[model samples]
Target chain A: MNNSASTSNGSTLHEIVRAEISRRITTGMYKPGDAITSIARLAEEFGVSSITVKRALSDLQSTGLLTSIPGKGIYVKDRFRLVCELDVGMSALGNIRSLGFQPKVQRISVTKERIEDVTLSVFNPPDRLLLCVRKVIYADEVPIVYESSFVPTNMSDKIVDEFGKRFIIDALKRYKVAVKEMSFIIDAAPASQEAQRVFSVPNSYPTLRRLYNLKTSAPTMSIVGIIESPFDRLACSVRPGSGRISKMNKKK
Target chain B: MNNSASTSNGSTLHEIVRAEISRRITTGMYKPGDAITSIARLAEEFGVSSITVKRALSDLQSTGLLTSIPGKGIYVKDRFRLVCELDVGMSALGNIRSLGFQPKVQRISVTKERIEDVTLSVFNPPDRLLLCVRKVIYADEVPIVYESSFVPTNMSDKIVDEFGKRFIIDALKRYKVAVKEMSFIIDAAPASQEAQRVFSVPNSYPTLRRLYNLKTSAPTMSIVGIIESPFDRLACSVRPGSGRISKMNKKK
Candidate 1:
């Protein structure tokens, strides 16, 4: 044995085993739908306790990277999830394009509305009505993001018609609303009915949501609005290099 | 009419109405469970179309701050959400304290394990096992965060035992691991079973997750770890000042 079972602290053993097995799946060493080695076999191969192998397999199960059958065995999860390296300043649209999918923006609605539920700043006139634009972004014709953008009401009409239908930041740039700072409030919630309808997912599908507050040179137009996307459709990764867009295997 | 409804662009009108009504509810002028003014009355008051008022109410309904009764009327949503202004550098524990909660860390387990699914850096030795620490952080005895930290296995055993039972940053400071840079990857997903067990929620609960990658003076000890929190237990807001510990109305 590489190390005595008694010497194993058991804390990190499963994670290592999990990672080794996860690597195999990621690299196609274990194809989707292929049954993985049994717990006893994995324990023997790694020279770890059976409990450690079970723990490792369980970790992978939680990640939706593998699944266990009642009597058969664990198999690579037969699903593809599209994960993007999304960040505050990075262009998600560009990222979609880089992922080999055609990106499109469909304008749902745009209107002048009063600001509600927003982070107040010195620049934003909390009492005044603002412009709100609602839209959906599509990757290869499948909706991925449902977004609402709020801006100053005084924005020019022509600009509103042509504003960043895809990005509020682009609209800010066009309006010459120089963004001095950009901060984020990130969270997740059950998909709203509107979100579900747009994404074609059922109610309560997990969603990734972000509220971006941009401090602009114009106090009145400092903040943008909110973005919501399906959890299965998007991934925000730690390192930019580590986020390679996976080929979405099916409609998520 | 104050202004002819026909003259209204209708785009921003409903949002303005929505914001005004939302403001009233937030300021407690309309208390929770208070049956708000009828749609016709609100429409007459605003001098816009009744459709606009309905739209406004529908917008508020989605926020969980208001509810619509089938036959009665639209009323203020009777719920409290604790929102915080979270940022990359702010001490979340301190934030919890500022919100009037006692923060405590309960160590689950610590072990030496191999690294996988991590951001590789010049400093991190991808081939070696590392120290892993798992723990839960509580706010007023309510489990809020489940975290796992990874560090070089070469760390002293004393350091591992004491290593940031609450924070990896603290351990890094003690070990004189000079951090050169820090980056983040953020995403959300359906709560894993372990998360459900920790948060005591049912399956399919949404969760917010983040991974932090740190570059330190020592190449082998670059990245730190991950943190997972139940979404309903946390509300990340746009401004730090806006984040205040809310009264726990009931167990979430």
Candidate 2:
């Protein structure tokens, strides 16, 4: 979206102007919470009209890189710190809590059913019936995640009642089924009809889908599931300093 | 989309049939590399028509969780494993090499110009001039990433010629300017005109945008940049196992 092509210098004047001021703020020439030079002075110094300089300041403000007080002049906001990456390992309820939102898991249905082929192929399993649980997780009363899981029938009685309240892994761990490893296949798919209904999103909405397996330290780990959310509603990220990044770096 | 709503017993017959067979395969009742029961046998046992059974099998195949041989039989594929998360820290050339594809860096433009606001705010002081490097990174002759970076004018001469051949960090590190840590803000944004043209994608395409900053150990990081790709062309993922997932867990 750069306007570099339109200008003779191959750089937009407004953008360049924005950059100069931003550089000052980042380099501690303009410290955090420091008042910036007036727009007119900056415009005159950069040889651009006040309007052009204002657009640049607005851009910075929108990105949260700068802050504008009601009547006061603009000031440098905090440095661009990392927004924590979304943790896929945390339970839906747990994640909502982490974000400072009250969470609720509304259990929609639970049934003992034969495991489906796609899910079955991913886990160490039993040939018997498995408990299939479907629920909608909400953050601050707004439905956000549609989750469904299939677990061994033997573990059904232990979690059926509070199924919506806790992560299946956390619940399973209570039975000494410690999850040692997990894997995820993440993709964007057209939302399923059930997902559409639960999320109140349009049909064929591009949904971020995560299919994962929970593996225990024991020779077996059979719990597998899917979590789907509208792409716009979720924030997914990763940082180099967290989790098993070192292990992956080592392998590389 | 689920057909559960239209079916009795809280599950579709075909899905149930799929689940039963999948359970068998997952439980070692049908081991990996072992041929599954014939379609006719499965159809009979599940009391579903051949088409239903075929649909179930096809669903499994699409997920890369199962395989079928022509006229031979359906056999279990390996258990679903974690697809490698794209390493955001790796250089464009290094990432392409890891993907087993020859990478080519087609330098689009390099100009010494004033920096833009959001970018300038993230980096250190620049003496009014900055080197803006833009390039399309290709994998197997297909453009997969559009990357652009901004650095202090002082380092422009150091990397201008080989800019396409090396990561800016690596080039800087050669001058003993080491990067100690980096952070990312990953978001989905409407594709810009430049991005749309480069990726041959539509306007407002849900472009995957990664904006990052590299910092030296000294209380500050200077280089700021953006990497963008068409959403469909890439799989951007982060495993919770990597990095300080434990710390994130503690915060929760």
Candidate 3:
């Protein structure tokens, strides 16, 4: 009937039907592959319309918890067993390695240049200097991450000359600068045309954007931004217990 | 010409062009808002086909680094400036709140049920007992997350009867079972027909799936799997600070 009022309170006949089936599946009352009660049957049991029951089933299907075959009943889908957390440390690298992922750097450009206010704010250099590097990192040669990073220019005058270097971190090591603290922010937005080519996604696809700060002590050393396609194709994992990086708080 | 190769590492002329532009962006040679080199100019400079240059520009656009306008050529897109992290704690709630999101839960069903092998493996109940709750949480009254959670049956007898009575965490607290640890796994897949209706997403839209493990003293208290629509709509932030839950590890 009028499901409008229930919308505000988060109660609806569709939700009721969906919840019933979900409870059965989670508690083992209805095992996977078990044929669920038909919409007609649920409509009668709940004393609601069949449309409501159908709506409820639809809610469960969207979450990937259920699958329906035309002319057949609904069933539960396979579930992933592992737990993953996104972090940046040796442990994070280890987790990726464990997943059998090979990280490859497709260097796009390396140049030394004057810092701008926006870039300077992220990588707070002591003087008017900065180095910028852009690359697309692939997992198993499948481009997944596009990154743009900025470093203090004065820290390494040789950065521009050393264009096409393999890894920026390795270059930093050559300059005897250790990365200490990092700040990160993540958001979602529509993919750009270039992103589509690298990730092989459609023009309208959405990507996860991650901006992070690389720091030595309290002052920021570098600012890096990465755009990941389709959001879920990339899984980041961090281990607990070893090779820990020193931590520092963000500047106010 | 003839850039195709059997192996995945084969570099096409388009890829090379993409690499060149990416390098310029990362090096600060082409700052944000700057007009990217024209397709004709790049094609001539690289001595490659215009098709190759076009493909490279399209790739960069999909990566969220470039924007193209009709008859106006391509330009660098504005970049966001926030340090993003994978948030696993209450900080996640804070981030969600900062977005002005209001969460509303609708109980789909509440039931007590027997344990089976599949449910046992996912939840890891302590004594063959379990209580199941199925819910759909909305943001701004829009259906976004669908969750099916399983709890120890004996831990909270008559849980199903408690429907529409209290908040989920509050009800669990009544059982003297505090959530000590949580684990999560995220993935992406195409949404189902049912999801299309609840989320108002068109068919074939990609969604994110998150699996959560709630525990007390290393024993599983509950297991929840959430299927979310417009998966990229919500931003995720993780803070790696000193906490009991922080001690847990993530595997990709």
Candidate 4:
């Protein structure tokens, strides 16, 4: 054993063992669901105290990579993958560049309608007119996000016809309305028939859905609601980076 | 029935049905985990076709409000009442206010360490010194986040002593280091022994672990890695609002 304390760094014996095992796991030497050696055996192998081996195993467990059963030894957890959260401002179109898969948008419809009581209550629009646009977003040609966006009616006449555009943020910018702030509510539920068709999940598959409110300096720009099936399969990452230029700067 | 075509305003039969059901669920008419009537029953109840009822149910399921079993009927999924994403930015400390519960930070240890090959490769510090701070953060006084942060040594001696500060973001800012960007890699694993103590979960509990990289013009901040027990209940809301932010923002 290279017992020479590598530098002045006094890494606990447990940390050293943990790092070695983590390397093996990340490198695919230990495949998913593989059983790690018994903690006692591992302790013997590493010439470390059993308490140290136990601590190392404990670290791996906390990272969601390992599972342990009572009386049974440790096993690797299934479907462990890193999720990266990317920040794309508040515009739906801003997310395109960072999406791991190519997203194709198919506009289902865009129409002007008298504001419903529910929507009116939610957006509290300055005016009673509303424009609703429905679209299906496909990732890798598979539909993953089914979205309906409600905008105030006076915004634009070309809203329905502009479905082929790659990003919605650009279109909103063209309308001279900038998305300044946004919020989201996410939940998991079962897939609807349309969601089943889009996500190719079983009819009974559960999904995660998010409702987003896009706001400018005005009351509200749009209410974008998305229906996603198999919510677990879709990884979400939320990282904050530099904010967009302030609305005042954009106006100038 | 209001057969006026304008009454529904081109909204799909599915949308109307979904809206009605969602209203009921959110209004507390239907409780979580309660089974909604079967498709046939709902169709008969609403005087709509079974296909329309199915579509609405599917929409609810896709939203994570409902779950369905192949052999059985559909039921509501558990609702997570509070979900907030922390952001990495100038206003990152604002995240504490967004959380449904107050966050309490407890510093466990502060130590100086020499950068060895493994530590060097992981942190890639410009200097050879590293400051380590270990802490646990609680939500509603329940320990949920156990973290260790490594800062470049030359930054300041205060980085080590400021361990007891309530907010790491504010502490870093006070030290004259601006956090420009943060990167996070999140995954699931089992809880470590230390995690089990802090999070108070059983050995079998799953955990969400994140490795966060806080950077400035130079990577001046630190790598803050946290292992949190798998939430027994998780809920998310992404909407345009003043008080809430995305979960993607909180890792750092």
Candidate 5:
């Protein structure tokens, strides 16, 4: 064995073994989807028992770098990347497609209600009625995002017609309503009862909540949406490089 | 209790109650830190039992919109915004400060080890030795982020000196190392045992993992950092409408 794989003193044998394998995966020696050496082979190579090798592999798998298929052998997981940003300009449909998933939109309900005092602030002349659209977005047959959007009453009919019409972005674009600005707040919170029902998770399940306001050039800039995802199944991410500026600075 | 707060027909009484309170908070009727009406008052106003009002408030609290003290009444939570983007040019210290937290750094350990294979691909001329620095970063006495950074052997000394010197960005800047590019992959993963120990979360707890490769203009672009945060406390967000472009598209 090379000096790099040599065990460091004072640490557990299994940790060194795990670290060695982890290094291999992160260093690109074990490419994604590549089968790793068998437990028997690794144990022999590392001069450890099969149990020790198993433990090491299990540790690696827990962190999501390696996956062991039953009956089959272990392989590096496919490198999965999720980037969350406003500038993508892609509709939810496009986003799912890019991730190799067929997205299915299940409209939960549509209701008209009198506007709350705070919600009215998003509108120019703050109207009385609002249309609330609730949807569950599924990717690859798994519900991934639960979205609740509140739009002004005036825009309800057009939006309802475009409900399943591909992406919400496309729907807005069809009406020549360009989303000029958006304000977003992202935080982690316990899943609500409705979220638990939608996601099949227990109460207090950690979930990411993204509250956003989409504004247009028109005087009434009044569309707000709340997107929620169970933290176990999904993540929201952003990469700042590649000519992208920080949106925090752009806040008016 | 005007028409705006009228209950939709189908939802449960508690749900309608929750929605009413949620709307009031979001619409600025109940500003952050403002106490809402008492449970008895709300119960009487909504013509529901006190248990129903309590349930509604509890639901809103679970979603992080409200807070309840032991003796004090329920009040809205402080407005918080965390914008995760690349161009802020602020160090971790600055970031925490911006969020009104007193940041503390707890250096876990630093070790020198032989390099792994896939990690080597991130560097120009992959070196053999690596210096891994692990730190537990706290905000207002709460552990918020666990950061493990791997630096190349040549830069270890200066980088180590920069450790806990405010933020890693500031330390790199002091060495005149300009991070020109960064590639990051964000995903949800079970908290490893070490992560659980570090963050005080349960085993297999959902956590957000951000694995990043940072490249400087210098020939050696060899620092990679993995940052993890408990799913219930911290979130990474991106705002797209600013001049910033999407980093996902810029990948080579």
Candidate 6:
């Protein structure tokens, strides 16, 4: 059983204002950690009453996009915008840098497993065993992405051995294993138990889950990456179109 | 306050098994509306015990990926995979068609308003009065997308007058209004009251929201499209890459 907040004509107006403010945040007009104009001033600018602006800002606060500090006024929270396109090959190290935050590998480990790793076998490993590389990438001090990528041992002996020590993307490039194909599945779901424990969020907190399947040209290998990030810690965004964007008709 | 179902030693194995099954559904190994083998069969195939398979299938069922019929058997639900590429600009019509479903415009209307439409003005319409084109696209019988796109009247008189009568993409093409640039924002948020009411889903049900901003040449107009779709009704998927995928380092 659930109840939606009362939505009438006034709510429609409230939504319009809230959506407008949200658009500014998403478009980077309100940069992370920037102060926002007072509600009364915003009211005058939008030509709406102060109540509308207050409601709009209040909604933003609830969504973790804006923060109202005690006596310090309101400011945009750093909802660190993450790359919407999953093809950021070396992004595990680059995403945080572009956002002006120090990147750190909070945790890293590698394990080799057999059929016991039914999950990794989806990569269709030719051999019965595969290598599992897990890493936790952080933005500044906060954990952002919890990733577990898999590669069949036969795909490349170098990748199986060096991925844990070196950047996984660098290992691929160094060994001349070119990724020819990739696919992504993006969804919004409750954070996994492991993510909840790692990120220390409440149970069932919403997360942006991205799974990528990569294919290599040499030795014909299959690699899989599973990335889970909480909504509060990441935002997926596209740059304002710089050039003509061909119609994106991606078949599932 | 919430409690995570106790995740113990067996839980990790359960997740691995569940994840592999999830990968299959997402990759279309099990297409929408396909029957799945019995839990016993899946257990044998994965070389796991029946209890592990049972828990994995139960988790998938709860997630709406697989559904069980009392007397019949488990089958894949119609997750209706939609385009992950929010640039599906015109795919409001094409997406369903590509999925082998008939698409119908459930509702179509146009309106012109001033500053009250702050949400529309994010497009930065040149005129005080902007044209808002709103439509609901349906796949077969279920409403899949609710879209509201705006165009400043001064940019294109034809668009303001004729968009309601013709396919929007066609109107843009016929008028030679080429989109020079575009950007997208994709996120998962609780279903809006409008979406919940329209889609007949629960309050706060998870929904995929995609907002797009389009820029055109010539008169230099700004266009914006806001789309809200329920997760149960639509999914964002990328096809297995056919050609090499360029590094997707999209700057927000």
Give the number of the best model, judged by DockQ: 6
Off by over 4 Å in 1: A1-90, A115-128, A218-220, A237-252, B1-91, B114-128, B235-252
* lDDT for position B35 in model 5: 91
lDDT of 3 at B51: 78
The TM-score ranking, best first, is 6, 1, 5, 2, 3, 4
Per-candidate TM-score against the hidden true structure: 0.60, 0.56, 0.50, 0.45, 0.60, 0.61
After best superposition, candidate 1 residue B18: deviation in angstroms? 23
Question: B18-54, model 2: which lDDT tens digit per residue?
Answer: 6666667767888877888888887776667887898
Q: Residues A122-162, candidate 1: write the lDDT tens digits.
A: 22545667788888888887677888777677777766765
lDDT string for model 5 (B1-252, tens) is 333446443267777888888889878999987899989888888788998888778756645577676577988876543444434423456667667788788888888875453322433434566787778877787777787777776665756867654446566766767677765545555565678777655333556556667777764565777777766556555555355421323321
- In CAPRI terms, where does candidate 1 land? incorrect
Which 10 successive residues of model 1 chain B have the least lDDT summed? B243-252
lDDT of each: 0.65, 0.61, 0.53, 0.54, 0.64, 0.63
* DockQ each: 0.19, 0.12, 0.09, 0.12, 0.21, 0.24
**What TM value does model 5 have?**
0.60
Quote model 2's iRMS. 6.8
lDDT of 2 by residue, A1-252 (tens): 233333223257766766666677767888887889888888777777998898788656533356676588888864422223455444545666777778787888888887664533544456668788888877777666787887766664656556666666556645656566666555454456698677654323445656667666563646777877655556455455533323333334
lDDT of 5 at B33: 76
Question: For model 1, how does the per-residue alpha-carbon lDDT over B1-252 read when each residue is reduced to its tens digit?
Answer: 454443313348886787678778878988987999999999998888998898678656534456677699887855533455434222366667766878788888887777664332322545667788888888878788887777777767776776546466555655666666665656777676567678755345677777676667764456567777877667554432211111111111
The residue-by-residue lDDT of candidate 4 on A40-129, one tens digit each, is 887887788888888777656644456566598788755412123323322333344354556577877777665453322433444445
Residue lDDT tens for model 4, B1-252 = 233332233267766777777777777878887887788877877778998888678646534466677679888765543343433221222443464557677888877765442312433544545676778766666565676666666656665566455445556655655667665443333455677566544333444444456676544445444434333333333332333233222321
After superposing candidate 6 on the true structure, give the runs of residues whose Cα lies further than 4 Å from its correct spot.
A1-80, A83-86, A89-92, A108-129, A155-167, A202-204, A237-252, B1-78, B83-89, B108-129, B155-171, B237-252
Predicted structure 3: lDDT: 0.53
> Model 3 - which docking category?
incorrect
- DockQ of candidate 1 (2 decimals): 0.19
